[model samples]
Target: MTDRTVTVAEAGESAVLDVLSGEPADVGDDPVGNGDDAAVLGPAAATVVTTDMLVEGTHFRLDVTNWSDLGRRAVAQNVSDVLAMGADCTRILVALAVPGHTTMADIADLSEGIHGEAARSGALVVGGDLTRADVVVVGITAIGTLPYGHAPVRLDGARPGDRIGLTGLPGCSAAGLALLLDGRGDGPLQQAHRVPTTPIGSGAAARRAGATSLTDVSDGLLRDLAALARASGVAADLDGGALPVHPDLRQAAADLGATDIDARVLDWMLDGGEDHGLLGTFPPGVDVPPEFTIIGRVRAGEPGLVTLDGVPRIPGGWDSARGAN
Candidate 1:
């Protein structure tokens, strides 16, 4: 007898789907979730929906990460977007395009990751689609709900007298990616890239704390801030000394033997995307939430202009079309 590995092609769609659908969501003691044609979520306030896609070799590399990590990444990024909206995550929908050669074990690993992260965010996997494709493609749609009487946060609400706030360090994930590319893929920085931890519930916290505008730092701080500035018709001036720099990032720069450690670290802090931290603005004299650090201020100037230490800084963020972050 010979042992053989089973692939998605050999298992067929029904079996693959069965493997992908873990435990169905329990709605009022009645199970309602994936495996059905569509998901049925309970009633809620204003619903907020966001969808994102991750493609193999473009958004991630299989050589550096496993299917489970990819699954977690897909869910985490979308949930971050939901948090940016000042809403609470309720459910998630995943769509996957997998090559035939992929193994069933890999799909199981992916499912585990998806469900695990969803659980962490107080959400459930309600529905999704699985299909055959040339390469692995993961699509995540996160559903959230604004609390009763609270409005969704928008980028256009910032005012000239607002203070800019950030929830967490901005460059950890980017530094992790750099370390991975350098063939030194260990330590906190690398872990940050593998599965970036988002500041859960921070969006709602900011909203309740009188945040006038909000966004997730999925892109670089300068880029996302500029967008908020343009949307609100204001200019943003960042205090470079105020931005938090992770110790791991500084050490990574040293390990890589960069001539300009400060410059390299600053680049990651300014342009490194995927940290999934919350960035927003609060009105003057409002007590910013404890979770947020005041890093900049909104001011009267040219719209969409962002300055660092009183100097105009060009914004650079993730551009999938260009295949760079």
Candidate 2:
């Protein structure tokens, strides 16, 4: 069905709450959710806050994804930051600025996506605002608490000789984007880019295993890892052979009938973004959680440098202000 344009008056605060269906957070002091001017949340032993926004035509496109996916992806972006800090998100605040022509049903779908993903992460919806804009921009703020230990993981703690591990697949969403651009829509690989999933439980697992540093692969493996390396003041030696490539990329390549599929797939793994996978450094001899696949090691070398199979990996990452790589 085609979406209808919804006005700010028609999609009021009550309508927004009804669309969410009380699916957001329930742990806060303001249990009623979305009626008052502000929300009150519980005090934490250590609380972490993160905010991320997804703008149409920049972070996403309406032609490829529906409003529901948009909402979920927006929430996912915020959650990944908390998870990167080695915490589980406890609540979310969603602010939506939509075009005047947007439909009420579309708003509902967006709320459904946000609430659904938050529920999956065991996070509740707190409160936010709906304002008018020329285009769609979904801003989400995630509040998280350290679940496993005294301190949340940071990007600056990695040491030389530490093992580098990644908690989820990195290239799936990139492959999905490739498939979508190649006109294969609605397939599994294509959907990966539309509503990409992350390893939700791995943050706590990494904390339990005493992860020294952590961050998620948002911009690209090398790009994000390079940031981690710079933060930790160490070198990250990535193993090209050890990096796990999702088979879907190869499948997409086969379907596209492309030459040099292996090299192209490697490019996607190396430079793609939006995967939401956690990458971290662990102490030597520490047993990484089962979900982590060791793809590299922190070693003595140039600080903030990353190498793949001992060769320096040049940065050709996705730059939002410029364009996707």
Candidate 3:
């Protein structure tokens, strides 16, 4: 036997599909699972569908992130989308495009990452497609279900006197990216950049806590909040001092030689994307969930306006066309 690296081209399309499929358990007990032409999900009061695509050189760099982390990040981001709408993720469909020279080991790692994340989110990898491309592209579509009694949360639900809250730290991922770009060092922040984690059940919790409006911080906090405010026809005022800054993130700023540490940390918190934290508005007089910290309040003002500490601030975040932050 020859010890040779098996490339995707050598394995052919059939074998590539098999590797991506993982195991029959990956599909759970769906009526039609992996290897089938299509998937059949159970009935629900309503269905939620969201799609996200990550391109090779754009969304990620192959040298920095392994296939496993890339796979996990792809699924986690999409799952956060469905959860933001106050729905339970039940199934997902993946579509991959990779160059022929890609190694089979990389494909297997990618598949394992996808399956692991799906299981953690209580979702099934029912079906997907694999094909050849000049660059690697991973596209995933997540499906969520809302039960009869629960209503799907909307971006337009915020009103005057509502309280703004956040579930997780915002700047960790951005700090991680900054370190990676500067070739600083490895730590939790860098890992955060590689494999960002979402607050898995926070969306449903916010809904039960009477969240008037909800969104995930896939983009920067200010940008996502501004969009939500625009949809709700209200203005958001964030308390600059109240915004929780991660201790590690602060240390990262100092390590990077930031003259003004607070400013740099604030920049990451407001402008960093991909932390996958949940942001929502709760009606005044309602006790917000403990998982969330009250950071701001909603008031009547110019629609889509976002301010930090009573002063109007510009919204800055990741814009796909504009490139990485």
Candidate 4:
């Protein structure tokens, strides 16, 4: 009997790191390059590191998206994660894999996009590598530092009576994605699909306002809220009437035969992902910032349960592997 062996690609930076390091290992401190946005020495104030990947078809579509937009979206999403951790992003390291058929101009445009978005977040592209591949794949790793001795607001801290706050409106990205897939031409929906404007500074703002728990809305509100519930050992009940939906999305949903606007909006709000807004929990007496709206409350219950209008959550939104099917 012959044993099957898996051979990883050696062309791209991530692939090289995977092959050499194996299993995405992280070494906190190193005298040399350390593979982080910046070198680390001993323990300083606070440091946070996050990495994310965007595949060509899974995370984006090249047909309607420009190279620059793709680049910006990739970087913005990763930086959003860092901010969700209550840290300010300082630098990023990017790794790109391009197919042989890809042109230098395409690669340059992608670089320009990455730099452009990074600059907006007050972060710099310190180092990166590029190589040939069968398709385009972008990986970004961001590093940030928190204030001295300030503990990051993790998901586990949400108490039974905590008030839930959200930074911005939801469903625009999901609605936009639906529009693009439905063969709708370029418009606001397409624009949402192209570039996601994340709430960059709101994470720190939430932290300063005494947020007990914090997370970014990446994997739909329900899925991510479920995570927060599990982490905090509680139940999340969202006010159906309070969920804000974009007007254009409602019109678009109606055109697409989605009769119940609430369901459609809930699908986008609870199930839709990639809004990049901060969802956080605050103490009962704490005053949430003006930018945040009270959407719900956290209560003591079995871990990993989320309720919409007082019932178990149903799936009708985005899943990366499922591709909105």
Candidate 5:
């Protein structure tokens, strides 16, 4: 019998190196594992770092989502976090774990998707690692820089009498998911599920407009608003009637025999995670930007949430590892 040995170079190390050096666009002066075991970094104005992971069965279904959409979503969500903090994304580092059965072309296409989305947000993909796993998992760590003399907005600053607002419509992604799960063909709802359209600049705009607290509505609007309220030691009151429901979602729900579009929209908007819209609270009398709509108000309380219509919204918030599944 003969024994064979496998080396890192033979097991895709060279392929990884090629991606780092050749595949992505121009590599700037930044030192990225060329020689030393560590990549060096210089001081910058402000540094904002965020990390997010997408699991296979939970965050995405390989059969339903394309490599390009997956890549764009991973980078876009992380960028949403930086924007939530009123920062401009600079670069991202990705870590991928995939089953050995995955094709090289899929991996390459995914990388291209990441590169394209990062570029759209004015960020670059700096580096990453790859490894074998039982399922496909993508982790992205994004770093951003805030403008000179500006502070990152945080959830703890919301105050009583502040107006709660949201940028753009909600429940589109969730509705889209429902449509796809129902075997609906390609359409607006399905597109919403595949690609969430986040308001890229609203975070910074809110900050400049004197927002006291802010967060991206990745996990339903009500749930994230609850988080902001908890962090700020206030109570959030959302006017249920004031929410913006995508027109397509309304039509799709009707087509799918969904009895109450309002309930469905509310469920997705308040507890259906992954929308990536910006939710914020501004002090009274502050001029909110045109992109945002006033959805509710902030009040003094035991760091909890409520509905402006005097009702308790859905429980079991958008927990990816729990509720959504």
Candidate 6:
């Protein structure tokens, strides 16, 4: 195979930025270059900001994913937070800490991935800094804007009588992760683990449909939803049978040689993290979006109480200090 590695000096920070931001000479609405110290954003009724970091061996592994996919994942995760607020991401800042062994082509591919994701989300990459490290690290900060007369959706907004719904697949990433660990799954399963994509537009759709509260599944579904319930001081009861467990999860379990594949898949759906799917609570009588599936409903109970089929759901999830998987 041809060598694709390059030293920091060989790649040069400016060259990498050029690759990501487009030719330095071409000026867009907000030109991305080494000159600007900060990005000037449009005046909006409300602004929402969130940041996330991905470190080697923690959030990802170089052996399992490529630079381009990693870049996309780094952006996608931060965007998820913005989406949770029921706002649209307008811009992002990307910072990198790369080891000496990382290649120039690697950075180029990563930049391409970031640019592609930003375009898909209708966001721009404005600025960032490059630094040295023993391993690859990505830090992304996403800025979002809400329309006039709209407010950022908060976890505390959920109330009794609200309906709970979810957009897209929740357990695919976790199942993909299992496949990766088993080292016996196909490319798609491994791809989901490396760079899972969320339905970025679902947040706006939820807002339009009068969602009372919203959250993204960065952590396991139960864990994150439990936090939302705690913040709202209510209970979230989920129908165990209502979960939209992706078909791929069952296949992944079988591929991993699990005896009770159905039960294992259920476990992954409840406890798996990093799917980036959006979960929201809507006020009673409000119409949920077509993209969403009604999984359960909100009710009065002990604060932070989350149950699956009337039984208390076990608390197990992704911990930054401890691996989520």
Scored by CA lDDT, what does every candidate get?
A: 0.87, 0.82, 0.88, 0.76, 0.78, 0.82
- Sequence-dependent TM-score of model 5: 0.90
Candidate 2's error at 259, in angstroms? 2.4
Per-residue lDDT of 1-325 in model 4, one digit per residue for the tens?
1111222232334433333222222334434343555544445489888998898877888987888899899988999898888888877788878775554445556767887888789776665666767878999988777889788879788889988888777877888888888888588766876788878788888889899999988888788788888998898888878877667877888877897976776677677788888889998888798888889999988787888778877544556677663
Any idea how many clashes model 4 has?
A: 0
Tens digits of per-residue lDDT for model 1, 212-295: 999998878888899999999999999999998897777899988989999999999999988999999999888888989999
Candidate 1 residue spans exceeding 4 A from truth: 1-4, 28-32
Q: What are the per-model numbers of colliding residue pairs?
A: 0, 8, 0, 0, 1, 1
Models 1 onward score TM values of 0.96, 0.93, 0.96, 0.85, 0.90, 0.93
> Which tens-of-lDDT digit does each residue in 83-137 have in candidate 6?
9899999887888888766677887789888888877888878878788898889
Model 3 residue 199 CA deviation in Å: 0.9
Runs in model 5 with CA error above 4 Å? 1-11, 20-38
RMSD of each: 2.2, 2.6, 1.9, 7.8, 4.4, 2.5
Best by lDDT: 3
lDDT: which is higher, 2 or 3?
3
Per residue, candidate 3 scores C-alpha lDDT tens digits across 1-325 of 1112689889888888888887776444456677867887766789999999989988888877889999998999999999899887888789999999998888988989998998899998888988899999999999988878889889999999999999888899999988988886578898888887878888888888889999999889999999999999999999988888788987899989999998999999999988988899999788787889899999999999999989999878898778655
Model 2 whole-model lDDT (C-alpha atoms): 0.82
Model 4 clash pairs? none
TM-score of 1: 0.96
**Native-referenced Cα lDDT, model 6:** 0.82
